[model samples]
Target: MDSALDYKMVFDALVVPAAVLTPDFVIVAVNEAFLAVMGRTRADVLGHLAFTAFPDNPHAPNDPAAHGMQVLRASLQRVVATGERNALPLQRYDVETPGRPGVFKERYWSAVDTPVLGPDGEVKLIIHTVEEVTDFLHQLRRYGEREVDDTRTALEAVTTNVYARAHELHDLNERLKRTAGQQRQTMAALKEAIERQRRFVFDASHDLRNPITGLLTELEVALSEPSTDTHEILSKLLRDAERLNEIVADLLELARMDTATPGDAAELIDLGRFVVEELERRPLTAAVHTRTDPQVMVRASRIRLARLLGNLVANAERHTTTTIEIIVTTDPPDAVLEVIDDGPGIALADREKIFERLRRLDDARRKDPGGSGLGLPIAREIARVYGGHLYAADHPTGARFVLRLPLAT
Candidate 1:
């Protein structure tokens, strides 16, 4: 009896919610725990269907229960044939008493069914065991919700980033298009200016040529006529006309200098020599002292550079009434030629605007314009072509013109 009871105790300890159903599908035996859960004694539960013993489900163990029992029979048949454990996991109601409806009083059941075979090689009984798994199911539901939220957040972030990048690209393209259009407009304006400059030069030359030829012809006729009071009058007229012809010639030469092309420039030029040559050629009332130092060479177009210096010296000679001094000064990054004269000084207010074409500051000079009003303009254009500039300096004594050119190669 002790040995038989020992086996029974061992089996009961290993089994959970253990019960046995007979070959005819009746609840033939149940463990002490199973009977306690039903609130019944061993005799009361024995020989009843498993559902009737529990009263939560009354059709089970007579006909197989719908949930696990339906799947259990096939597994149990295989178990009986092969002599191995067959498991069918399922859920079922295990209400404690009449007070509980859908809610179980103390039982939340997850069940697994296994077959118990007879000596005749058939399944005589089926064993069922259930565990309460309420906490485990709650954890599964929480994990599922977190996964869904994380996915939604990532999708929203990607969409917003794409929208921002698209807007930035659109703005950059618009700015690039505007810059290209402005460059095109600037090129068109430069072309138009060049065309107008060409037409002006052609017309000025044509108008001045006929009068110059007639004046020269009339001067020859006067020299042949005899010396008398009438001859003196004609002589004065011829001399004035000759001066006028010279002025006209100077005007035409200045215009030609304005439109001439720059050819190959020499590698180096002597600044002192250029100033000396220009001063010797110019006829002036006052002597200009040359402080030019010959060693100081400049990188310039020799032809254009010579003409530029001649025009500037002549301009100073025309303006100054008395003494003129030419100074050649060198600086750290540039070579400067300054022509300082004792003449009617230019007004401080008009110094800046006087460098423009045909802008003589004095009203008397404007009316008695002896030379073509093109000397300064010609000088300025020459300076620009050689990467230099010509500007007037305001002074208390007289006007100052400074020419700045690049240093020698």
Candidate 2:
């Protein structure tokens, strides 16, 4: 099977706006619809980073988090990091005007980024697709405005006829009251949407602030010292950038988990096989061993389950240096998986606290400042979504993390 040919055929065939980007986010190919959306030719974007070609509105040049740039970057970075599809919220992304080279026009989009895994099972390309919702949103705004105008006109007519007839005026008053009630409901819904958007921005900004500030501080210090070591400065800059990337990826996953519902689609995943595959894909210093009942299976979202398992193993790797054990078994109606590490274990007091969002031990923070403090919380959320629970218990040698899920028929 020629993956390159298949990629080309699929890329050219899709009518929906789409582009193919390298793992580093360089645009290598785009379909006509995507080109139309950006108002640019292949020659202009083919070799450039996706963000470089269509930057966020210049009004926010200094504040990438204020615009949708961070959200979009986070979505693409997640696909690259975790090899999972990610959807961005409806964003007010602006694109270059057709004839105006540097000028941008306001647009709204519902965007998604999906990973294209290579034969080696690593993410090689990311397919970015977006649906332009600008016109639809404009239509909605117009409809709302028209309703307000009609309400005003009706109110004026009623006021003019207020002295004409008492019964008629009473009927008009009742109708107006009902209209007001409906408008209030609409306003409430709109307010809720605004609040959600505000919360999303606040969370993103809060998580992004630290790394960015650190990056700037490091650069400033480096610049102040004329004899500063360029190599050392670059090394610290790279680490800070990587830290920012990790935080963004975790936030994206956390957002996904927050919106995941019990009604989400499920698949029958073999516990033993899945555990082995996940372990094989990750790089760890600890020697890993597994014990499993090959027959055990669970009906759950494969991505979510993989995420849960991956987080447990990753947490173990961060804390332990010697050996890791992964065991899978079944107890009648439930399948159980446990990860045990041979390292300093968590205190009994902090076992449950570790699963809370952004909660990390002082020791763990000292060990790894780049940790987003979201992995355990996200893993537990995924477990609950699939009618399961994840917890850490005291181990004689080290920490023991366990995941339990309903067995598939």
Candidate 3:
């Protein structure tokens, strides 16, 4: 048999507010946690009927059916009768203050009661554990009330302010007219921005898809036929990969320029020498001709100028079979560079629209599957950044792409 002192020590060691009760709901033992929570000494509750010691508050409303004592009694009885644990949701329970006896303090608690069975499988005792939730419940109620009060105050202020202005009809009409005008302007600008973003996404996806598709297809075929001449197959795959890399790089450059303002440092570059040098860098099967003014010089970003010139020249070379002609001339405040090719010239209706992102001719697509359709658009964007312009015109036999930039002061 366990000693009474040992049982008391075990009960006092429990951390949760727990008590052991007999089958008739008399308190047998209470832990230190229960003593602290209930604000009572062991002598006050020991061997006392549970409901008798902490009965429903005498000052509480006379509604026995809704009382805390009734609810607690029902839960404890259910646990003992069914031989199963029972849990009670948070409920109000007033406890007598320790020092000021007979004064009950308001509290809320969440409780659970479990049956302890003996050797004969009968309930020997009931273990009841409780956790206090009074402070938390009160804080939550206060917070909700504060929010409602704030909302009501704001609504009242708005109502009063609006009613006070009801007499100023003419002034209100004028202000509303101005506000409507401003809204129209804002909507127009927003619409334009949205359209630009839409086009950018569509063209970027379309331009990037081709090379990526080719790269995947090539890799798949190469992997499937291991016994074939892998060296040749790898060379083709390498070219496709390089093409994808170039398209990605161009797309990134376009994205950066879209957010960039255009004040890069400008330098005076000799137009004739610049044209000749740039042409020499290209690997071309078509013959090249140059007609340049010796004194032509432009003040611009050399990198942008180079990219614009390279794109125009490359477009002419790739799209046409005729000899390429490079021309540089001065027009007082501006310098001009022209790249002419004996390819089919752009249609009159499509000339302006061709500068749009992803605008490509059917023949061009057939001739160059690797083209990202970004070259011309990017070239024109670079021209605009340098305060210049690029446009295509009808050549006698082919196409003429002209570039104009501010001349060096």
Top candidate (lDDT): 2
Give per-residue CA lDDT, model 2, range 1-409, as digits (tens): 6545675667677889998899999999899888888787899899999888877666545432225666678778767876878766556677767778778776767778899999988999898998987786565556655777656555545433432343344346546656987999999999998886686577568768988998999899898997999999999899889989988888877777677574557998999999998888888777899999988999898877887888898888888868899999998788999999988998989999898677789978988776877889889988888889999987899989989999989
| Number of the candidate with higher lDDT, 2 or 3 | 2
Q: Clash pairs of candidate 2?
A: none
**Model 1 lDDT tens row, 1-409:** 3545675676556546677776555677678776555455788778876545554344333322223443444444544554555444333444446555444343334555567767976776777666655455444445555777665545545433443453355346546555876888998998887775665566456535545665665566656765545666566667667756755665665566567745555558778887787667666666688788657767887777777777777766777778777888787477888888777866778766565544455642663454545567777877877778888886668778888888875
Angstrom error of the Cα, residue 355, model 2: value is 0.9
Instruction: Give lDDT per model, in order.
Output: 0.63, 0.80, 0.79
Q: Rank order by lDDT, top first?
A: 2, 3, 1
Better of 2 and 3 by TM-score: 3
Candidate 2: worst 10 consecutive residues by lDDT? 159-168
Question: Which digits, one per residue and each the tens of the lDDT, describe model 3 over residues 1-409?
Answer: 6545676777788889999899999998899999999888889899999898788756656522215667678778877776777665445677777688678786767788899998988889999899987776456556656777666655545533432443244246546656987999999999999998898788778777776787788778878988778888788878878887988878877887798855567788998998888778877767889999997877777777778888887788886786888899988788998899888778888778778777788867887777877889989898788788889887888888888888876
* Candidate 1, poorest ten consecutive residues by summed lDDT: 58-67
TM-score of each: 0.46, 0.48, 0.55
CA displacement after TM-score superposition, residue 245 of candidate 3 (Å): 0.9
Clashing pairs for model 1 are none
